[model samples]
Target: EYLHFNLFKENKDTFEANTIITRLLGLRTGASSVTFAGTKDKRGVTVQRACLRCVDHERLATVNQRLQGIRLGTFAYAKEPLRLGQLKGNRFTIIVRQIQPTAAAATLAGDALRAALQKRVIDEFAEKGFVNYFGMQRFGTRDIGTHQAGILMLAGQWQETINLIMAPKSGESATITAARAQWAEHHDAKAALAMGFSSLYGSAERALLQWYARHPELRHDPHAALFSALPRNLRTMYLHAYQSWIWNQIVSIRLDRYGPTARKGDLVLVDPAVDDVDDELVSAVDAASAAPKEDADAVPRVAVRALTAEEAAQTSMFDVVVPKPGWNVTYPDFLLPHYQSLMAQHQLDPLDMRRKWHECSLPGDYRHVLGRPRDVTVAFQRYTDPQRPLVPTDLDQITEAPTKFRAAPAPFQALPDVGPYDALILGFTLGTSQYATVALREIVEAD
Candidate 1:
């Protein structure tokens, strides 16, 4: 039986949450036994559905007892496990704090100006949808973004991929930084393996180093070996990150040229029954090559067409789709040139993505060019500090006052101080692939 439950996570990403759950259950099952709909931000309080295969209520209850900053509830059984992007959407309650007006405007209107500006920002977002650039979280927190590493992998530059993975990025843990530094100086797999990593954070790096130690004969071809040692999900992530980056650039360019509205040659979704010539070619290749079929259904499919003049006008009501370029996907007529140019800039061809050796081949899909938050509502409230304030200036000299304060504060306690600042509380619902932070960025210009 597949067990489904509502999972509440705080300050953890999906991967971390899964790791914690795995440890709590102490199940010998592999990662595939657990599944989730979509990943949540590492820094937020998020609630989502998750599933564990062949687990019982008593076992789950025991697991729940050991967990902190995570809660599981509303358990049920289902025939199938939860899959990524399988949910309708996510609901969010976000608070934007320390809101204030610009200095120039504040001089003219004071506190009232801050409220006016905040209201205007919300009103504008509710009326006009924001550009759907994949946020920085998608690229990762590293200074050298994950997409850059993905580009190298797609180019069949495995050595470069290994180098990038081993190199230290800003904000990495001390253990990771030291290990990378040692690897950089010597380029000796044996020595690198000997140097123990003190933290569990460098699993991928450790895996790569261990692979190098075991297969010293393939030192010249470390990239292929290194890629093989990495987890399947992580290898796939490289390609996905690259695809997302390309989509972001295309959307930015389109918005700069044509605004948010759709135009002739823009993409519109078509019935999936319609035959896709490109996908058929890919299927033929896969079948003839005898590639694994277990993951075939997970491959993304492109089923869209260019919009005509009349159809383009209706884009405001319909979704405007952009291709996440893959070997089996066809580019829109108007945007094809842009797509080709971008690929060429990266020194890559679309056919180059068919890397069956690593099983990292991408079957591209489509994402909306604009994301509008649904059920959006906003409110303002004075910011208050809940913590006790610093001791009053004369408290040290007033011993009698302290005794009286301690004795008289049974039911008539004074409230905490309220600060001058105000906060904007935004509540909204967005589709599975959409990001609430993206909408927030449109209003607050958040980094």
Candidate 2:
């Protein structure tokens, strides 16, 4: 080893709290960062450890189980004699680069990106994974963090307030602001995968491409305030179910969330549980349009009036049936503990869970190891949320019939030909040592 050579810390950890306003500030006060010191080798030496912990989920045993499983694979077993190497023992010199970001101006901007990322990720995960709005069980987990982070990054500083106002519509719509805030989210997902779960990888990849499909010009919706003001939880559920039943009974895809472009319509005030939410929206839009105005010169509006606070408080998209997972549901099996375990063991640390969604475990972790390693370099990606592919729509632009879905289609790539092209004549030679090597790899990888 050279004495005078300069060195740099390869693995740098970064994060930003993704919560409502007050919580974000709390993070700047060191809500997520903490130091823990434990004895080394059962001797009188003190060791310093810096760790990230979610205060909300900390006390929850489920959450603790999750964190411990992660630490085992990443720090304690990430090297050596394979099985016993579940954590990286004593290789890395702990260096903490901590910063607190405060930018209230970016609130609106951050939300837009979050929603867009959520929709694309959820939609693509369900479409490419199991049918019928599957959940985390499908192949999406691996990239959830990365995909979310990537979306945040892609959002960056909006060119204008309009861009911020028009960002995508989903849970992520407001999760963050400033594209630079994504690194933390990206690493979180990557960390999950490294610990041993990769089932979510497929879902994450599809989400990445789906988000790519939208141009930044398509960010806002005039009707967003109306939707945002909608109610939550069970109230939204009953209304959504009724809407889905009606829309599905008529249209093809469930239209609980279609825009005026996709749903040309009228406006009306009616109970969502009784009246179909889709039809009610349609009627409301129509009535609002046809309502006589005092001045003929008055500018026409894109969306109608906002729901009363009472009405808004009653509107939600999540359902009670959610997560009731039936038999064979992939719950804790593929994405959690195991995936996290592997990452911990492999010393595969994700750089930023909030940004750079496409990168696997951070670049540095791949190089240094202090334990017995497993097979995965990155966990598989797979997860699903039914509330995906949401497009923001302006209330004024509702001329009926979505001009949105008419965009150019994505390119499709076909896999190479497989199996024997002939019957018995060619088949006999095919399995006989010729394709044995190929078959062997498939068997190994598929499991």
Candidate 3:
């Protein structure tokens, strides 16, 4: 029989064991393992509780030092694992310990989560001497501006963690000394169930538990009770659907250029909210990864279709459309003649349009607004001074006049009568959903 046990500071007295089990399990960091080694069942208590202990203050302290360096959430892991009585508490000490994983492996939940757990462990032991189990946030910033350097540090903390993984040596003391961040995230996730902070794990636990179910051996465990109240299948569908929502929102904001589209359990570290604080991090990653976010180079070269002799002065809405390079300027069937006029006024030569020419970027791509509705999209359209951005369209067309009707002034051109190219097509929903996609991108990437 397998017993998942968590150990903690037991007041030096064995009987008062369950006192803080709730707190221990609430942490969102670190890995824990429990084995029945052998249970000494006594008659004093009844509600099943777990028996576990902290590994060592030094190991924990080392982790804490690493945590202070990066600055996300890391205070939880310093405590011990919390044990729940598989059998209602009858006082008994279950031999349990924190072990390390063998290899660098990926856990679908994501790496930011693992770093979170490590941060907790480090904090718990910081009272004593230590070394970082989570590695360092040190990265080169020779070209980044001074202000951007600080922003890069803040934002790239997670991205830089891509290097912090502790590869357990044969002589290492822990089970998984420093497994891949993903593995720690999963292990910590299971450990966190013992903690009271279960709500923080809403979607993650469901996905992991489902993955655990694939192994018939663990499937029968009572842990299934955690999700029994929800639909039998809702657990499986949560992640994918959530990710789809995220991708849709990001697409709507035009921030799908970053690591967009999430599957049920895919690992994504780009959060738009953080971008505001560390805007340069995204730029740094993008600059290094080439123009991956825009994949501007990937568009296939399509042969331009020449207008037919009779179609030269075409009458159809689509007829007026001349596919411009790099612009999403297709004339949808829904476009009206009034829109053409709007488009002409909106149009500018190549140098005048910074975005289409790949001239600028939002602080971050919007990932948070996924599945959620957005009312508007904003961006720095003129790019240069006046420096004012423009609102291409109301995503929902919900804004009232004067209240939300204020749009940035654009330098008007002598445009021919035409339809609006920069308009919203709500009959169909886009992933980002708005023409001024920068805000949509912002929305999509929000925490």
Q: Give Cα-based local distance difference scores for all models.
A: 0.66, 0.22, 0.25
List model 2 lDDT by residue over 1-447, tens digit each: 101100111111111111111132254433113222211211111122323343332222122122210111112211122211122322211111111112532343333533433343234321222112211211112323222232222233222222222233244322332221332234232333333222221122212222323322332431232122211211122222222222222221212333211111222123334222111112221222224433212322222222343553453321101111111111122122333343344232122222221111111100000011112111111113223211121111221232332223333332232222211000011110011222212212221
- Of 1 and 3, the candidate ahead on lDDT is 1
List candidate 3 segments past 4 Å from native: 1-189, 192-197, 201-206, 210-432, 435-447
How do all models score by TM-score? 0.78, 0.14, 0.17
Q: Residue 441 of model 2: what lDDT?
A: 24
- Give the TM-score ranking, best first: 1, 3, 2
Go through the candidates in order and give the C-alpha RMSD of each one to the true structure: 9.2, 30.0, 28.3
Estimate the TM-score for candidate 1.
Answer: 0.78
RMSD of 2: 30.0
Q: Sort by lDDT, best first: what order? A: 1, 3, 2
- Alpha-carbon shift of residue 256 in model 1 (angstroms): 1.2
